[model samples]
Target: MFTLPHHIEFLSDRWVEEGRKFLVGEAPKIRERPAPAERLRGRPLSVSGRFTQAPPHMNLPRDVGCFSVHFDGEAFAVTTSFDPAADLVIEGDYQAALTGAQMVGIAAPGAFRTLRREIDHLYGPEALKVRGAIADPMALEVLSGLFDHLGRKTVENPDLAHRAARQGLSGKIREMEAQGYTIVENAITPEFADEARETILRTLSMHGHQTMNWMLYHGRALERLALNPSLMTLIDASLGRGAVIASLSCIRRGAGPGFIPIHTDYSHVPEPYPAFAMTGVGVWAFEDWTEASGPTVLVPGSHRARRHPRSSDDPGAGVPIVMPKGSVVFFTEGVWHWQGDRTEAGERVTLHSHFNRGILRSLEARRIDEQMIYRNPPRLGEMLGEDDWFEKTTAAGRDYMRFNYMRQLLAFNEAGKQAILAEPQAAAPTKSARRAVPA
Candidate 1:
């Protein structure tokens, strides 16, 4: 079946090798078809790509990433060097190029136009630079089709499976399904939590406010944490694919009484909420959460009630979610929850990442920041609502490119979730067993 490897780092040597394999493997079947064979007529075609500002994590050997694929009518060759005389040359920001590659397949027939529109809208026109020209117009279409097929076979979130397995998230997912909430302890390293806490406090100090929204834009730390792979997997499982960010907010609470009352997150809805969840929230704790430290309290199995908690409804004393620092608690499906009283002297800092299903409107307005999109991967754009079809309209029509792209992405995510769920649950290690392992 020539299945792809479970993981392939983008722009790595392995990625280039797999790309060559895909092209070489698919070319024969493509040539067997009469239309492409007649159009090619044993003539040669080539494509050269140059990507700049490669993210440091890629650790690319070259300052500027370059690759060329040459088809000598009957066979294909892939190389790390560029070909100036190639029929087409694609040069752009590496991240934008990745976003294009992930989406090209869904924008077929108008792939070129769609790609240009998306790049212009998200990364500015200069983000993607095209050069050279195809002698035969049909050759351009053929090349587009070939790239589309190649893209579908490549360009995916490589960390989902590894992160899920490493974190033992299947058990957490099962717990969430039954209890309407689950906590991932030590999800982020204590070092990261300390850094994030400092950033939030500094931001709060500068702004002279106790709370803030759009925290993702304030610093690199918040931005990175918002797209945390394990947290994102939980969000996808609870809210389905194509979930957009409703808000990323921060709060610093001092010793005081709990101000927020018990309620469900479902904002304007009739009685008996839908079986599916429309929104979800992941709250990150920068410090150890204890009963006296004022952690969130959740009514176990209250989501099954499928309605808002009435004032007269005594849900009894709820369970306080107590976990160590660098942990996050995610609750969805209209879970009834509220803040706990803070009796301790120190302040508690938290960041809340709230997301809504793709079909629903977000609480925060969509803000497309090119620098933000360029700095991160496509995952950032997806959360910012850049990859979805909603609210994208002009006199011409709705943006079907984004619409189809999201559809394809959602299907892929669902498949990934199913695979995660199907895996056997591993038993938790005892304290002594954990201590025996090297740090």
Candidate 2:
């Protein structure tokens, strides 16, 4: 298990000195514009960069030194500071800045791998680059934290875990409607949970390493678990009769002090928290969610806020949703949540399934086909995204791609008049706006 504090100490005592010897000389040159000026001419786009020196002619407070690249309706303006706040901000290591600036709106043809290798060579010997160790859990945790700090804040939703105790699996759907989320205890049988756990472990062992696509390839238990009658019923009630599966993945947390930043799952879904459902997430806990084990922490009643909350807004607002092994937790994509600190020994795993109304596309659209469809039970056709509803586009030509789901699609298109109103227009930028640089 990797702990952030210990990793920070390690960096201070070891990595930093080694990095200084090479990184200082190898870092990319900070000029007025690293790329050509023509690339930004007349393009309606903007992005920001962080942790480096500010560009010339751009004024910012001494403390906040981020820079921006803007394309005002006509000309491109690259400067430091947010005069007209950028549409996106690129943050992370030097490579992120180079890649982001190079490919602003259009794709650029170049060998990104070669570029990275050349830069790493300048940073010093290969050991100082820390590439090989990134696969280690501790190293990955440390790298995640460093990038998060260098980049924009993940979520602005306040932590409201304090009010979680008020909910005890009563008035399940009603509670979700009022508060934007709810928890259901004993949602699955102990035997089912055990089977799912074994399936998950076996799949992991077969792969020999962790990758994002495991849920799509293996884990029959997970696919069956998604079709659980009770779980589907809950989703149907909230997202209407034809809620479809957006993604089905497993979350495993080994004994460590690993922490995921607070954020919402609204990336695919359109913003301006709607009155109805767009995307919903279900987390089936396979182990007891306790303080020592570091279960998920969420803000109670935050879904109604219709906006993402910041960690700084009220950090204490969050409470951990502790439950037994057979329990499942359901929340709208808008609800703010994050992984809590795990100080205990052993590994914790949860089956994560996200559902969206039929009008939206599935996150794992390509992975699910006729062969995989035949394996699941008949009742799961709609939720597993095996029906015609997933095939046809709405009258307004909007589905998961344009709008989030049915509710947002219907709300935005009233007959022919488009009601494209931005909710809480000032509630910070979307997650994409925060980290524009793709890793």
Candidate 3:
């Protein structure tokens, strides 16, 4: 009786063939509107204050923000509201801004900055109700909405979409400049990783997806995040289940790209569950994400920006991540980002994935009828692909096409992949890792 990793498994093509017998309806089409918060605000609510603090991961200066429990205490004005927690001390100064250990750039002052130089991203609730400490249904709803919205449109504000497209090759350059990424090890077993990769690639092939957006791993990638197990195990030993998947999937480099742009990753639903919510994203480069194969460029701390600025508009901050395979480039997803073109040649293989929990799929995207998927030009047989042909999923009893609990569960099963910093790991270490160490 071997214990299978939760939510993932391998299925024989024959077994999968038989499972597709009775088709389930496809998921509902999505609306291009803001977010799906309206649906989940049903739970009750309350907002309170305590002398607590955010998890260690969310404390990065650029990643930090000021929130007032009462408008009376400080003259400060926070752009948005976040979850209420105990032990969360409302700091009136910049000391909590950022610790030196969290700072990334060499040009920045000192060992590290105490506060974020600026606050760029803001997810204000159009209408929110903060109760005592019961959890605001509306805020939670907004968080869930942002999570889903950012999934499809990396740039939550589409106004920045086309601009972030970066030289029409997608925003790799800007992604590198604006946001950084991280690489973790042995987060997922090879067997589990293969399942995730196969699911994404197979899904893409079935869909006949090609071209710039052909990076199916972007929208459909994993959202669970893991630090160096040393980092996580060390932290978990301190916080227990309170440890959540803070950030995941911030870059994917390719070739022949140009232009740098802006964007953000929706992160209302952090990983592990209720305790880990409201964090951003991170990325790991498996192959060499170079100038040749457009690499994700980013604007430092741009997660606080209105949008990811173009490299053309702003210079210097833009660095193409020459993309050494083993380093972990950790950055906030809510920050601005884009990509650079492959000055050389050949494409790079980078995987940007993450893990999060508690955000529900919008009934807005719910597929009540199997016909929508069966008939959808974008989701037909080729897209959903040979559910009949090649292989099948053991994801039975779960709604593969519906916006039910399973979608997130499926995502969870694939979340928190050990950041792969080199070529696929072999039974024995490969030469690729001779230098794939994190900076």
Candidate 4:
């Protein structure tokens, strides 16, 4: 049976009724620039005269939050505005800078659509000004480098593939004990990680081959998305402004190796602002994914936290996202969930490649390579734009959101994703710090 968490129940009005209806038979289109597939990535043509420029070291205005780093998008060099009251900041890495420029190139149209949609919903109006693509592309260029690292380092490493697998498992255990969940960022070196790509794919493929809905996996999709400059820039745009994870992982089957309970990432992390400004998980695989194989089924907006704990009620207390190989699952992790898609056939296996801001603690047991992020498909250029919207993607700032969420949640490993999901929030402050909880 399918169940949904409450936080984003409002979306039911659209996501379930309209959105699901749209996706039931027809899948989202794959185009150079297709509209949102209830998500991001890709565009068609560049807008004319939309790109703009800004002086070095200057901030545009708070109203232009839509433009990520366009603090000063210029021709010679793009500038990233860190502080709302400051000028744009300058950086180097032209090859990568070109990538950011590419993102800016698309921002005029890309950001417009995204902001329009977002504003329409939350803001209840188009408060975001859809300005032409101005603002230097430099800042975002540097930002796009995040995905670049993911591709380069992992793919380049000779021993990385195998190591990542074994290490991932090991790291998961370690992080679970220390932090309740591990939040790994760059647990492995770039060159070293490259070797693990194939092995990772093999694991998912072998385990997924027996399933349904997700039998189509190629293993190279996420690698491409990692490299796409526009996409990378969008991911990077959040580098300084907000939280960006180079890599992320969460562990369950915790509390001595049973099943995980139901829960959400955002709920454990929650919203309202960054006590740990959690983020969505963008997973990539070395292969294709299918529903039968083991895709993570998400109860969208569970990040809003309306689901009650069902661990006391059922082992599969919540829904397990059925993520297709190479597909990214962007949802608040602190919500409700329990692993599903248990086909009684093979051992469950998967790898998580994620990103997050630096300040908060993560559930990953290992680090992620950012260099490789740009090399793979799901090209980066189409992922992020360069104009004011592009400028807005430059994320940079300290974030503590989602810190120790995994660690704390996993403490109840004996429970399940649902059991953990059902656990009440700490109405009263705990006596020990999260780190003190001891796995």
Give the winner by TM-score. 1
TM-score of each: 0.64, 0.49, 0.31, 0.31
Model 1 scores what on Cα lDDT? 0.73
Tens digit of per-residue lDDT, candidate 3, span 251-307:
323345565444445434332223222233335454545555666665554444433
How should the candidates be ordered by lDDT, best one leading? 1, 2, 3, 4
Evaluate all candidate structures by whole-model CA lDDT and list the values in order.
0.73, 0.49, 0.30, 0.29
Arrange candidates by TM-score, highest first: which order?
Answer: 1, 2, 4, 3
Say what the RMSD of model 3 is: 22.9
Candidate 1, residue 47: CA error in Å?
23
141-222 per-residue lDDT for model 1 (tens digits):
5666655544544433433443354345766776677678877777777767898999999999999999999888888778
* Backbone clashes, each candidate: 0, 13, 76, 164
Give the winner by lDDT.
Answer: 1
Instruction: At residue 181, give the lDDT of candidate 2.
Output: 65
Q: Per-residue lDDT tens digits of candidate 2, residues 353-408?
A: 78887667777754555645544333345455543334547687634432333344
Give the C-alpha miss distance for residue 115 in model 2, angstroms: 56
